[model samples]
Every structure is written in structure tokens, then in C-alpha cells.
Target: MTTHRRLVLALQPDMLAICRLEPTAYIGNDVLNGNFVAITKTDEELSIICPQENMPEEAIYTKGWRCLRIEGPFSHDTSGILASVLAPLAEAHLSVFTATTFDTGHVLVKEENLNRAIQILTQTGHVVRSENKATVPYAIQ
Candidate 1:
């Protein structure tokens, strides 16, 4: 069996919303102003993940998400990083939505599952720290 190294993830301090807009819809300043935002445009729709309080008025969204950022400046050829983290969560039956940037991966789990998710990750040997400096064994509000 191949052993994977434990990952360190940082929990962002903002409540987020995932929104879907028409593919042609214009993105506004509200989303751009968030401390963390991700916008993806596909032929079928435009998906936006941003701070819940900054979502556009016309968005069709699901609220109450918390983000976990996998610490990295991993090389482009790095493999299995995301899978290693996600596999354990999947085995625990936790639902997650993920996004990747040039440097790292981000996982978003609904607010109701945040504590359980953190527990599962830590139990699996990964370290989770909060951006707001909350101690380990996270007690996020």
C-alpha cells in the first residue's frame, strides 16, 4: 500500500455561498470584493463561490458553507494531494465541493458538517488550523 503524507489545511473564516448564474450573466463587484472568491464559467452556467454576505441579489444559491484550504505551493505535477484528503471524507459519507487553483485545493463542506468534517480529517492524520486562530479541535461558530 502506498502511504500518503498527512496534509495541513486552513479553515477560512468566512461563511460562504455557492451560486449559479446564467452562462452569459455578468459578474458584479459584490462577489469580487470578498476575501475569498472563485468564479467558474462553463457553457451551461457561471458558478460563483463567495462570502455569503457578498452574493449578488439575482443569484440562485446555496448558503452556509465553510472552506478548508489545503496548504500548498505544490508543483504542477504533484499527484494525489486532493484525492488523499477527499478519500477519507468520502468514506465518512461527508459531502464536499472542491475547487483548485494554481497552487492548491479548496474543499467546502456545509456549515452543519464543519465540526464533523474537521474531526474526520484530524482523525485520519491531517492537521486543520483556522485562519482566525481558533485552536485545534475547531469550535467554529
Candidate 2:
């Protein structure tokens, strides 16, 4: 049986820009001080980015990108929220990445469409919270 708990939509402050730099995307020293980019040491070559003044010297190649996120206080059994969120993004032809903490779940969309995604979430009755703020308690995945 599925369980129901509260879920909210959240996002990081800056937009995430992604780059695929062979197998060595994020190995070198960060040229931009704390520019908020991540190069995953994964089997795949990928790095998600935010706005950085000093971009990499090696030409950063990007195939395509989208803003991705689902914020916390969400429920697995919530009838419409997940469906509601994903449906529209799906319709808009966007992809998503998801992570979970102790109390909530997180979804990540591309950086460009975050504003639109937040607008949709708010208009549909989900509350967005800042990292340092308090949002509702959700039993998330």
C-alpha cells in the first residue's frame, strides 16, 4: 500500500547549468571562487553549473538543459501533487532529477525554466521555502 505525507516544492537559488567535459569535467581547480558548479565523479561525464564569470578554458559543451526540482513536505500517496508537478513539466518536455532528505524530497529541473515551475507550484497551492526557513513537515521519499 502507498502512504501519503505532505510535500513541498523547493529549488536552489541559482540556476544549474550543465556541461559534459569528457571524463575530466570537474577535476581542475575552480577558477571562479565558489561559483556553485558541481562535477560529479560518475561513470558519465557531466557537470551542472550556475552562472560563473570565469568559464572553463576547455570549451564547455552542452547538449540541452532544463530546470529540475521538487521541494519538500511531499507525500508519495498525495493524489495530485506529484502528478500535478510532473504532468506539466512532462507536457513542456522537461526532464527531472530527484533527491531525498530525512523530512522531505527534492526534484531538480533545468535552470532556465525554474521560475515557471515555481509559478506553477505556487498557483497550485504548494508553499515554497528558502533553505534557512521553515516549511511544512513532510514524510518524503
Candidate 3:
């Protein structure tokens, strides 16, 4: 039997920018000071995400991303939560860029895709709301 879990997601107001650099590229202090800054280096590329305005003028990036935050202080043992959320978006042909903090997961969908994403989430039984609204408790059923 398939079990449904209740999840509450809030749309964040800030616009996020993402940049890509060469594998060995070094980022300066300014970019690191963004409201949200992330850097990842793999064998092929170094990718970064930060508040849009903080992105260096010279950096090559794709901007205009809106964040949908999953309300969580989720325990370390929580499993399949991301999969549960991502599966529906994937099925709807929506693409997402995901970032995880210690306490929660932030999924960034292009600004144009935000509304469609919210509709899909709500249709799937997840509560989608703005960050400022009061949140109700989510239960895993």
C-alpha cells in the first residue's frame, strides 16, 4: 500500500542566481557573502548559488530562480522525504535545482515555473503557502 505523508511548503520571496566556473576557479569574498552562497566543485565544474544581486558582474550564470522551502527541522533519520516531493515534480515535467541545509531542503524552480510548481504540489496533497502565513502541522499518514 502507498502511504501519503503531509508536507508543508512555503515559497520564498528572494530571487536566487546560479553561476558556473571552471573546476579550479577561486571565488572572492564578496560572492561568498551573499544571503545564500553555495559552491561545489566536481571533476567537471564548480557551481554556485547565491542571492541574485550578489553575483559578480563577470560571472556566467542563470538567474531568476524562485525558492520553495520545505518546512522542516526534519530528523536525521527521515527517509524518502525528498524522493516523495521530487517524484511528483518529475512526473509533471518540471525541473528543479535543489539545495539542502541541515534543517530543511530548498528547491529552486525557474520563476516562470513557480506557479505551475505550486499547482502541482497542491494537487498532490502538499500544502503550498507563502512564507509569511501561519503553518499548520503536517502529519505523515
The numbered model that scores best in lDDT is 1
Model 2, 46-93: lDDT tens digits are: 454433443465637442233323554555564554565666556667
Between 1 and 2, whose lDDT is larger?
A: 1
Ten contiguous residues with the weakest lDDT in model 2: 132-141
lDDT of 1 at 8: 89
Instruction: Quantify how close model 3 is to the true structure by its C-alpha RMSD in Å.
Output: 5.1
Q: What C-alpha lDDT do the candidate models reach, one value each?
A: 0.87, 0.49, 0.78
lDDT of 1 by residue, 2-90 (tens): 23669889999889999999999987786887657999999999999999999878899999998999989899998889888888889
Superposed on all Cα atoms, the candidates' RMSDs to the truth, in angstroms, are: 1.7, 7.5, 5.1
Q: How many steric clashes between backbone atoms does each model show?
A: 0, 21, 0
Best by TM-score: 1
Count steric clashes of candidate 2: 21
**Full ranking by lDDT:** 1, 3, 2
